[model samples]
Target: MSLLHAELRLILRSRLAAASLALLMALSALSVVSGLSAVSRQEATIARATAEQARDLAAVAKAYGKPDGEAGYAAYYSFLLTHDRPSPLAFLALGQRDVQPTVLRVRALSLQQQLYESETLNAEQALPGVFDFAFVAIYLAPLVVIALTHDLVTSEREAGRLRLLLSMPGTGLWRRRIGLRYLLVALSLLIPAGVALVATSAPAHLGLGILTVPAVYLAFWFGLSLLVASRVRASATAAAASVGYWIALTLLIPTLANAAITRAVPVSKGIDLTLAQREIVHHGWDIPKAATFDRFLATHPEWRGHETFEGRFHWKWLFAMHQVGDEAVAPQVAAYRASLLSRERWTARLGWLLPNVAAQGILHRLADTNLVAQLDYQDSIGAFHKELRAFFYPYLFFDRPFTRADFDWLPSYSARTGTASWPAIPMLMLLVVTGLILAAGAAQMRRTGRDASR
Candidate 1:
């Protein structure tokens, strides 16, 4: 205990080490605050948009409402707003939300056309991605670890302390030193994250993810440091090598994997779905009314016996065609989803070798900001869209009046809630890689242990 305490005191007294640690802690706290502010801004935008949407809907009701308003016209002209509310922990990961549209206005028009419409985001603001806690922990934390430990053994030898330190019998001072430094580094990374997360009211599981990344990444660095510090005769080489490894593992590999996966997946079907559905909608103008009615009846047999007086503009016939358009592009939508999932699967696989990406996958999955979460939210929107179609079908087909009372019955939008699950396989692989590096480094240190025994 005394030796570990003395060593930590020595390390703190070093201006360079203390400065590096202080920088890391400051950066971590700043990121947490920045992330929280971004999320709060998004939430405020959603709340404001909701009020605007409500007013829009009210105006729509006043314009479309009548003694016997047609369902087809109501469905055609009215725009329903669907929004995916950000989760509390979204501040931590801040994943694809910037690139993707969280608030979309979908009418009874072809859903495929509306779904692909990206919001007008400043691509430049998003080009670098947000510098949230995930960025700090995954990319910067390793560099701090390297700064702290890269010169550990080399400096001791340079100062002529290695010989005397190891000569003492029956003492595992080396392990104690490593453990204490590890604790200090871990606390520096975690304390700010924990405090900010609690203040933000983030879920427990997401906090688990934040803590998990630092542990795995820190372990990997500590191991590499142990090996490099022992093998390198001088301090400079160890620092250079450690920085190189950090850059290659964190920055290089993930970027390459992203490029490869995007090329392989080819998700142009999102566009295809939109174009195909447009063609289906336009085709409604040419098709015979009875034929469209027959097709609508095929799915909705309950409305078959309704009054069907022929007219130039019947609500039932119009709504039928719109639904047919949606059904027409079902295949294309499925293909688009398959492509997105393929991308996610590729990313998950890459996490095995790259601790940085693994941390990303875990954080996003917990925060529900991942591509998978987006897809799930889409599914929820589709279901609600179907409900909207169902609610209006009877009034249109049976020539029933759609009074203001019916507006209250319209389906309300709800966000999706996907369970937060850690990817055990990838996480285990990270731990294994981290273990191997540390063990190899420790073995090197052990080999040199007796040589320094003067």
Candidate 2:
């Protein structure tokens, strides 16, 4: 305990180390507060939008909610609001939430067109992304580690204390110092996150899960810093090397990997799907009712015998044409989804070599803010869309009138609880690689002690 106190005192004596610790803590706290504010704003926006949506629905009902309201016009004009609420832990990572729409209104039209509609986003705000705890942990915490550890041995040697300290110390002397520094750095990073988690009343397991990212990430940085510091005689050189490594891992490699993934697995199929659906729907207008009904009935044979229509624009035929449009582009939709999943798969595979990417992937997954989360939201929307089709199908096929009361029967969208599966293999690979780097650092530090002892 006394030795640990002495180490703390020594660290405080250095203005750079002390200021770095203070700055990191302040930044972390600020990030938590900022994240909380952003989340609150999002929730407020959703509430307002939901209220507005209700009013809009009521107006539509007032206009077309008559007892004899035609199912076709009702289905055409009435819009249902669907929302993707932010996850409880989203404040910590806010990954893709900034750009993705939280609230959307879908009509009984082409699902593909509604699915890919982009949300309105300010380019300036989105250019830099959110200033969340994940950014502090993944990018900035390492610099703090580097600042504290880069000169751990070099400064002692320069101060003419290394030889004497080595001669007088026990076997655990260096370990004690290193361990104390690591503990301090970890505390500085985790304390704000812990407080935020408690404030939000997040699940205990979730707190533990989020804490793991920083634990492993900080360990990796400390190990790399120690490994470099042990071999380098100059502190400046050590810090430079560590910063170079930081840039490569966090910036260069991820950018290059994303570009390559984009080329390797093209997602332009999403646009193609939309265009094809539009083309099919537009062409269905010119084609005969029998042809559209034929195509729709191929998949939905239950409605095969109910393919009778009287007018040039029958509700049943219109609905059938839209259904056929979606079915026609089903393969493109699958291919587009598959391509996106492929990108995520490749990104996870890259976690084997990059600790920053691995930590980011883990945190985003836990916070339910990654591509998977967005995709899950889309899936929930799709499911609700199916429910919408089913509800209206009975009314349209039988030529039953859709009244204002029937609107109550329309299924309300309950945001699905995101089931972001743990990336076990990627996380395991991260642990193994982090362990190896730490081991190497320990070995190098031990060798330094041995050489000094002689």
Candidate 3:
């Protein structure tokens, strides 16, 4: 206890150590605050969207609620709102939420057209990414570790205390120093994170699960720092090597990997699907209506007998044409989604090799703010769209009048339930990598202690 206390005091006495810890803590706290604010804004936007949707629905009801109102016009004009609420731990990571639309008004029209429409954003602001807790833990915190531990052995040698300390110490002298720094770095990050968990009222078990990521991540950096410090004989060389490693791991490698993954998995199928759907819908106007009905009825065979209409134009035909357009691109849609999932899978595979990527995947997965979460939200919207079609199909096909009471029957969208499960495999990889680095660091430390004792 006394030895640990002494080491802690010694670390505190260093201006660099003191300042690095203080700055790290402050940055962590600021990031948490920024994340909370971003989440609050998102919630506010959702609330406003909900209220606006209510007003819009009421207006649609008032406009189209006549006893003789045609179902086609009502379905055409009434745009129902669907939203993806932020996950409980979203503030910790933010992920792609900053750019993706949370609330969307989707109607019974061709869903392929509406699913990809997003509000324009400031490209510059989004390009840098959100400064959330995950950013601090993944990017900035390791730099602080470098600052504190890069000179762990070299500084002792410089001060002429290396032989004296190695000669007098029992075992774990290096362990004592490294352990103290690890605790300090962990506290600097986890304290703000703990506050955030409390503020957000996040589940205890889940918060702990999310917190484990940074704890393990910091250990990886510390172990690497210790390994570098033990191997390098000069403080400046150790610091430079540590910083260079940080750059390669966090910045250069990720950038290159992203380019490689994108090249390997082209997602141009999204554009192809949209264009094909548009082309099919456009051609539906010139081609015979029977051809459109044939395709539509294949999937919705329940409406086969009701396809006949007595007019040059009918609501049923229009709706069927639009549905056919969406159906025409089903294969493309699957290919597009598969391409995206392929990219995500490749990223996870890379996580095994890159700690930064692994930490990011784990945190974003826990927060439910990754590409999978976005895809899930889109799937929920698609399901709701099907319900919308079902609700209006009776009125459209049977020529039944849509009344004011019928407006109330419009299906409401239920937000997706349950959080994304903890990423077990990626996290296990992180632990294994951390263990290997720490083991290497320990071995290096033993060698250094032996060399100093001689």
Candidate 4:
């Protein structure tokens, strides 16, 4: 305890170390605040959009909600709003949420066309990305660790205490100092994050995982810094090497890996699918109504021979035509989704070797902001669209009028809860890598001690 206290005093007495610790703590806290604010804004946007959607629905109801109202027109004009609300822990890592649309209004038409409509976003603001807790943990925290530990041994040598410290009999001296520094660095990052999680009432187990990630990630950085420090005799050289390593691992390597993944797997199939759906729907206008119904009935045999309207503009036939258009591009849709999943799989595989990407994958998956989360949201929307088509088919096929009461019976979208999950394999690989690095650092420190003793 006395030794630990003396070391703490020594760290505090050093202006650079103390300032680095203070700055890291402040940055962590500020990131939490910034994340919370961004999440609050997203919540507010959803609430506001929901209210506006309600107003729009009411307007549609006012125009078309009557016992004598045409079911076809109501189904055509009434737009149902579906949204993907942010997860409870989303503030920590915004991920792909910034570019993806959370609120979308879909009509009882070809869902493939509506699902692919892009949302308008500010390129300038989104280019920099969100400054959240994950950013601090993955990008900034390592630099702080490097600053604190890069000179651990070299500084002792410069102060003429290296030989004296080595002469001490115990193998625990360097361990104690390194361990203390690790704890302080971990606390500096985790304290703010822990407080934010508690304040947000984030899931208990998820919060625990969030806390564990930083401890392990920082440990990896510390271990790497220790390895650099042990071999370099001068503090300046050790710091330089550590910083260089930080640049390569966090910035250069990840960027190159991302580029490689993009080249290896092309996701432009999404655009092709969208274009195919559009072309099919456009061509549907020139096809005979009976031909469209025949194709629709092939899949929806339940509604076969029931919707025999002779009018040129029957709502039942119009919807059936749109459904046929969606069905026409089913193969393309499957290919597009497979391509996207392929990209996600490649990213997960890369996480095994790159800690930055691994941390990102874990954090985004936990917060439900990754590509998987976006794809899940789209799946929910697709399911809701199916339910919607089913709902209106009863009215359209039976030729029953859509009344105000019928509007009340319209199916509302219930968000899926269990879609996103933790990537345990990637996380385990990260821990293994960190442990191996720490072991290597310990061996290097031991080797340095033996050499100095000679």
**Window of ten residues with lowest summed lDDT in model 4:** 116-125
Evaluate model 4: give its TM-score: 0.96
Encode model 3's per-residue lDDT on 208-303: one tens digit a residue. 988999999999999999999999889999999999999999999999999999998988845456678889999999999999999999999999
Alpha-carbon runs more than 4 Å astray in model 2: 119-125
- Candidate 4, 323-370: lDDT as tens digits: 988999998788778888898888888889888788888988888899
Best of the two (1, 2) by TM-score: 2
TM-scores of the models, in the order given:
0.92, 0.96, 0.97, 0.96
Which ranges in model 1 have alpha carbons more than 4 Å from their true place?
119-125, 287-298, 305-309, 450-454
Evaluation by TM-score, superior candidate among 2 and 3: 3
TM-score result, candidate 2: 0.96
* Candidate that would win on lDDT: 3
> Which has the better lDDT: candidate 1, or candidate 4?
4
Least accurate 10 contiguous residues by lDDT in model 3:
116-125
> Stretches of candidate 4 above 4 Å error?
119-125, 269-272
lDDT of 1 by residue, 352-427 (tens): 7776787778878777788888887788878778877777777776777766656667778777766466768877
Cα RMSD for candidates in order:
2.4, 1.7, 1.4, 1.7
Write down the lDDT of every candidate, Cα atoms only: 0.79, 0.86, 0.91, 0.86
Cα error of candidate 3 at position 228, Å: 0.5
Model 2 accuracy (lDDT, Cα): 0.86
Clashes of each: 1, 0, 0, 0
